[model samples]
Target: MWKIGNIYFIAAVAVIGGALFGFDISSMSAIISTQPYLCQFNQRGHDENGLCLGPTDDVQGGITAAMPGGSWLGALVSGIVSDAFGRKTSIQLGAIIWIIGSVVVCASVNIPMLAIGRVINGFSVGICSAQVPVYISEISPPSKRGRLIGFQQWAITWGILIMFFICYGSSFIPGTAAFRLPWGLQAVPAVLLFLGLVFLPESPRWLAKKDRWEQAVEVLTLIHGKGDPNSPWVIRELSEIREVVEFERANADVSYFELFTPGMINRTQVGVFTQIWSQLTGMNVMMYYITYVFTMAGLSEPGTNAVLLPSGIQFVINVVMTVPALLWMDRWGRRPTLLVGAFLMCFWLCINAGLFAVYGRAPYPGEFTSTAESMAVEGPPAKAIIAATYLFVASFAPTWGPVSWTYPPELFPLRLRGKAVALCTSANWAFNFALAYFVPAAFANITWRVYLIFATFCAAMFLHVFFMFPETANKPLEEIEEMFDDTKPGAIKYIGTPAWKTKNTRNLALRQERNETLSSEEKMGVSGEHKESAA
Candidate 1:
């Protein structure tokens, strides 16, 4: 592929931050099914054999719930930091916390220590999740914005694939130390990311917003490649930045509460709820409990190669699908790809759930007749069910997977974008925590029913996108803002009101008068400053 620009190299650095974000997510899942971790609380737990557990259920549940609960705080606090500091600083802080969390996890001797460490790691991920995408989005050209942000999703999948193999590989090593080593392996990326970020620049757009124009120019020049700092490309982007900043300045200040103001409320609602809907899709439930799902599919043991194989392969699939997502996002248009992805997920999830339900309710032909005959049934439908489950994984890899991370940042106005993105991300982590903590219980009660619930959510998401979501594909940020402005009832009401009519008439005459002084080049979309007066 042709090198797009220095931004592509910058994207490479940005993706490492994303890799750490992804690594943290899939790291815990790797050891979730291992010994000591899985069987630690089992009362009558068996060692490497069909084991029984003590109050393993209650104790582990409490511990697991604590971890994601901490994650919730991590995600919530990330917004404040990202807004107060900058995305780059916040992400760097996240790396420090991640390293600390990893060390804590590696050395943990008790449940509280483990929980605290998980909380720290969770916090790091929360910040990385929000900041990495924003940083990538700010630095990216609009033509490649979708794909650039899409890289974050891809990195996450790669992390999952790596951890899955690490777990799979370690499972054969024959001791508690074996599994513990894999958990410690997460520290590698944390260290690499920390080192990498030191050499990277902050987002030029973000710097410009803070009125650090000179710094913004330097960063933009480096990101556009070692070009003359005053070149046309550099000049063009700086001009865009000035226009955007001026536009935002004249527009009303958008505070958190102002997020609910009449003219701005719809964007806020979409920004917040789209995140809520992403979680309701039940993606996390599967991600968090894939091991347990594997167990139920007849693994019968945690330390087996077979169990780890799927885990690794799932990760590989996630990474593979991500490439296509970035390629197709702009070409396909946002709404269609997203909606189609959702619907495909719904179909796959429903089929998986139904197959599992059938297997649970009735045995198949010629299978182990003992358990089947005891209940006048047949054999375990492990193969069919596991196949369907993996298919569901593939379904999520390209569709809801990338959209969940990309959509919020894409949809909001720049003024409210940070807080709105933060809130939506918080909602996502909240659901992520809930799903991670509760999936085991959900499975114990009715595995198939749990999936059915997710399938229903996916179907609903598909409909919601069809009716409500707009096509933001390949549109400049300015045009997207105007589109959302048109969606607001009060915006329309403001335009139609008598007060608005006078302002509109006055503004029109003012625009015509101003246009009379423009240079010829300026009239042709070059060499003139542009500004939007609306906040």
Candidate 2:
């Protein structure tokens, strides 16, 4: 049967799972302020002009957060599913779930129905987001692994950009169909992803772990050797993978409890916190609720194109900026990208917070709290906040954006890769759920102070990455374990030995020596057979 043999094509097709997540993001962001969505789902009833007042702060947050809440549960179970079934199968399952959720969301008539649909969609996102990177990392060559995994983030940005425009177009339609059209369309990419997976290869490392040696070699040959099973690079990779898998099989059982053991605890911390810090950077707050942020900037009334168009620009910026990371993350290295990203994000968030604190007006005593009136700041100050937001996203798109997804999956062995990444992704969604729920209320009550909170988070994340994250760029998955093992306990243990300081030459030399030994044995066997025949 024909299957996708090209690695880049495989990465591109698989990241449609990430796009499903993007679709969910804009599905809410584009329509949350629309009259049809507000009137249909809001329990609060209509205002003086008969425009829907929308749900109260708490209800709206729940509505927005429902998907990530579902995703949190979905991520936890995704490890089990992927481990038992396979990466490609798990992603196909997620695509099917997303289709079902899109149907529910399109048909939603009330807050509960809407939340339920969003939760279902979140479950699908949870499964895909955790596993896509793992699959990509496993199949990719170590030299290009960062670039390939970075595609997941790039795909996410594309999903966000595409869906936001779709929602923007649908918003002009009459009644609930405005929101319903885009919500229903969410299944389109999920459908594409399902069909696309039929032609993609399973992860080679995953096959090796299952002891299906021939199939594993075939996959590695397809990906790395142009179909030459005897290629030196393929032989070296297979050797490294088999060595690690055999050792792991002899020594360890796959267990969640094992992740917390002393030998693994540092990796667990780095993996889990890498995701936690990604969320706490407050980038998603922009993705999930950009309209709200712009509304406070007094761009226009909540549902107007004035607000939507500018918010759309951020999506474009997100997509455009991610290209740099895709092109050069392997060269730039992960640790530096993360550290610089955090620092710049801190700088941008502080500027945004300062603008709001200085120029924004508090809500008038009788003004409706849910509308832009509650925290309006117009003219130059509002514009500066918008600029700061764009800069903040620019800071994030190339740096933490891709690195966060790429870093964690590289930290574990084949035995722990699936579950370990799921644990980390769940941390991402847990905070995603909290912030999605909290930010609306925070905006309503605390105003500019919210930006300050995230700014502080970015600062702390900078410190965390500097101390805890070693560069995982340009290192083979089987060899990354050595970096952790080599760390000695002391004041500088947190910094560890940098990944760049370790040379790939050592592994290359070892593989060369092994190849020479194998060749000598083959020649000796041939000579002995000839001697026996002559005798």
Q: Local distance difference test, per candidate?
A: 0.65, 0.85
Predicted structure with the largest lDDT when compared to the true one: 2
Model 1 misses residue 275 by how many Å?
2.7
Per-residue CA lDDT of model 2 for 1-535, tens digit only, reads 6887899999999999998888888778888877777778767776665667788878888988999998998999999999998999999999999999999989988888888998999999999999999999999887778888999999999989999999888888888889989898889999999999999989988988888889899998888766667666688889989888887888889999999988899899999999999999999988988887887787755335567889999999999999999998877778888888999999999998888889988755433437433576879898898999999999999999999999999999899999999999999999999999999878877788898999999999988887767766777777686666544222223235653353333345445546644665666577779999999
lDDT of 1 at 251: 66
Clashing pairs in 1: 42-53, 42-54, 43-53, 43-54, 44-52, 45-52, 46-51, 161-315, 251-535
TM-score of each: 0.82, 0.91
Location of the lowest summed lDDT over 10 successive residues in candidate 1? 368-377
lDDT of 1 by residue, 480-530 (tens): 566556553334232232211211122333343244324323443442334
